[model samples]
Target chain A: MEKEVILQYLPLYREALLLTLRIGWQGVLLALVFGVACTWIRQLKIPVLKSLVTVYIELFRNTPLLVQLFFLYFALPKAGIRMTPELCGSLGLGLLGGAYMAETFRSGLESIAPIQEESALSLGMTSMQALRYVILPQAATYSISGIVANVIFLLKETSVFSVISLMDLMFTAKDLIGMYAKTLECLTLLVVFYLIMLLPVSVFGSWLERRMRRAEFGA
Target chain B: MKKNQLIAAAAAAVLGISLLSTGTVFADEAFRTLDEIKESGTINIGVFSDKSPFGYVDENGEYQGYDVYLAERLGEDLGVEINYVSTEAASRIEYLQTGKVDIILANFTVTEERAEEVDFALPYMNVALGVVSPDDAVVESLDDIGEDDQVIVISGTTAETYLVKNYPDIKLQKYDAYAEAKTALENGNAAAWANDNTEVIAFAIENEGFTVGIPSLGSADTIAPAVTKGNETLLDWLNEEIVALGEEQFFHADYEATLLDTYGADYEDTLVVEGGAVGTVETEAE
Candidate 1:
């Protein structure tokens, strides 16, 4: 790996990094919204909508993000539901991540004791008030680890955006390798950039998990 | 205690032997000579399995096209069975450098930059960059490309290099595969597609509502077989084979057999190089 080549390609990597962060954050935001909404519907036990949410979670969880992106980008254009590559990429990530997040949130919600709801009702709190004030705060703490894992998974999934010509970091690395045959240099830069993007999230997640555990157990 | 030590020695010997055997297998793959290939009884020739009329797989899963026709003849003369290795546009050089394929015949256009990486054999066909676009909004020249319109190109191709260097103002949407680039064009994701003249002409002929608005965008270049950098024995043999094949007008016959249906007679004289003689055809084409 030559120093000159790494220095020269740094700008391209920088541009790709910005694009990746933009799409990744947007996707994670959508995923969080979908997760909370789906969990609320299932918790309320809505008649038809609960079954529909179950079907959606199963469908998205069973299929890969790559197939979903291909369907949205290539196949949907035929049906006149065209979306730009960036939109398709984030949408695919959001839909896939939502299924995993919903499951994570549901497990957290299920862990709450029945006495907590009963106590809230005896205290004259409505069911909605109990869900908002009593259960959700506890569930957020319980679900932190799983939510962090889903966020990291969705961010890494942005690598496949190159297939739609979105020019993410992976695409830039591949294009440089193809044009110049600088495999060692391009791949070294790729690993470094990905570490730069992912390590912070991992460290922060660990810190948050420890804090939540300490607060809950008081030991 | 003695028995345990003896068993340990035997296990270490087995592991050493296995490692040495694997090492030799890798050593043999670094580079192979003409004689080495003949001894193997199967020579791997890399060609494109997607780019139609030049190198592509047909309905029966058999390789067919202009490049494959020549590859078949080379295998026949060498008395070895041909092993067709499908290659993409970007992996051509890496395939030759790594000894994954003995010869590459995937519409490989010779350039000075590429020649430094791999040794190119004598010329068989002449080629230049060409641009194809939709008929309703034809792009007659580079100037016609608007600021917002992107030109589609395959990654690592000569067209990509030329456009990036010469027409810096033009935006390019690059794809890794020909099929994807074609799909992008069909979907109207770009204003025009720039590729080899032979390919663009073939596309314009095959697909309706498209025309080759700009023919011959860059300097004329030759298409030839490529081998590893220092494999003189194989390189010499390929050059001699091309020259000898020229004696019987082999490339013209190849054009008739594989390219005639797509190109017709008009492009026959302009494209095919006889007897590895690129100069005569180069001048006439110019």
Candidate 2:
């Protein structure tokens, strides 16, 4: 590849990297919020809502994320719901991540002893207050490892956004290969880019898992 | 306990019915192409943003090329602001079918298989398939390629399909877009790259030490603007515009101005389409 072409590609790669990070972080935030809400709804033991949550989780979890993204980006607009590619990607990732996160939080909530909620309630605390002060604090500690892992999954999932022309890192890499005709160099750069973004998340997840394990054994 | 189970079954049945009803409602709302363009005021014209001399970005970071020039004219004709929607060779049809773009001006070659899904306007340009290889390589014909030799082609292109069907023995590496396929060729991932003669010639001219070995493989196929099927009003207007432009040889001027650099002094008559006129001379006489 010519030095000039490489130079030209750098900006596109940078933009794509930023897009991936943006999608990943946004999906993580949405997952956290929605996951917590879904977990709490399940905790309420409302039979109808519980079943609905189950269906939602099963549907998204079982299907491939690419199909979900295509549905959001291509199908939704046909129904008069127009969204930009970035929004479609993030929303799709968020919804899919939310389903997985709900299951993660559910497991965390289940691990917490029912006696803790009972004790808080006996002390004249309302259900919401007990959830806020007593239940969530413990659940967050248990779910932190799962959330970190989910973030890694979300980072990889952002690649799918390129199909709708979101200009994420994979898209940029593909573009570079096309424009410069430097297949190996462009692909190597993309692999390095993904590793740089994701390695830290993987390490963090491992560390958090260890800490959680230590906490459990200590108790 | 029995009552609770009965209530749960009723709830599940209700949920199933509601979901089915919502699905039907969505199905009933047919997507209209004209309505979408009018609503947005931005007519999405799918053009290849990477194919040089046809559709590519200039140094000024503007989308300026032959295809872009035509797309702008179409936008003006429609009285809607143009939004250049970049597409790869493979997904251009998907973009049109899914209503992501109103029309595809990408270097789209007309074929019978493609015509079933989308309607093609009169031929704006004529193109033939070609192959490019490194100058050091001795690839005279498709037969010269070894059984192990990998040929690079842009995914979802007629070249890719033709090679696979005609020469199944030759290995092929398909990329999603033109840029990737070219890169694959440059990096020695493939022995040669097959695409339209116009694109291959442009590549050979711009990049040193490359030559188009097979300049014209198939019969001349016309490249044209395409839209989703059943849009009679839009289709009729486009057909009229093509025939009108053909009378003055406007598209030839377009080729001379934008493409003559890549093609040079030779092959102009054989390679370039002079006018936008449609209909065989025999048919016209009848």
User: Judged by DockQ, which candidate is best?
Assistant: 1
Candidate achieving the largest TM-score: 1
**Each candidate: chain B TM-score:** 0.88, 0.84
Clashes per model (N, Cα, C within 3 A): 0, 3
The Cα RMSD in angstroms, rounded to one decimal, for candidate 2 relative to the true structure is 16.7
**Native-to-model Cα distance after best TM-score fit, residue B40 in candidate 1, in Å:** 3.6
lDDT accuracy of residue A58 in candidate 2? 90
Every candidate's lDDT: 0.86, 0.74
**In model 1 chain A, where is the ten-residue run with the lowest total lDDT?**
A210-219
lDDT of 1 at B84: 100
Per-candidate DockQ versus the true complex?
A: 0.16, 0.03
Deviation from native of the Cα of residue A15 in model 1, angstroms: 1.0
lDDT of 2 at B112: 71
For candidate 2, list the clashing residue pairs, or say none.
Answer: A178-B179, A178-B180, A181-B183
Q: For residues A1-219, what per-residue lDDT tens digits would candidate 2 score against the true structure?
A: 255656766776777788799888888888778787888788788999999988988988998888887677556655667675568788888889999999888888877899989999999999999988887777767888788878888889888765554667886666444333354456556765776688667666766766665445135
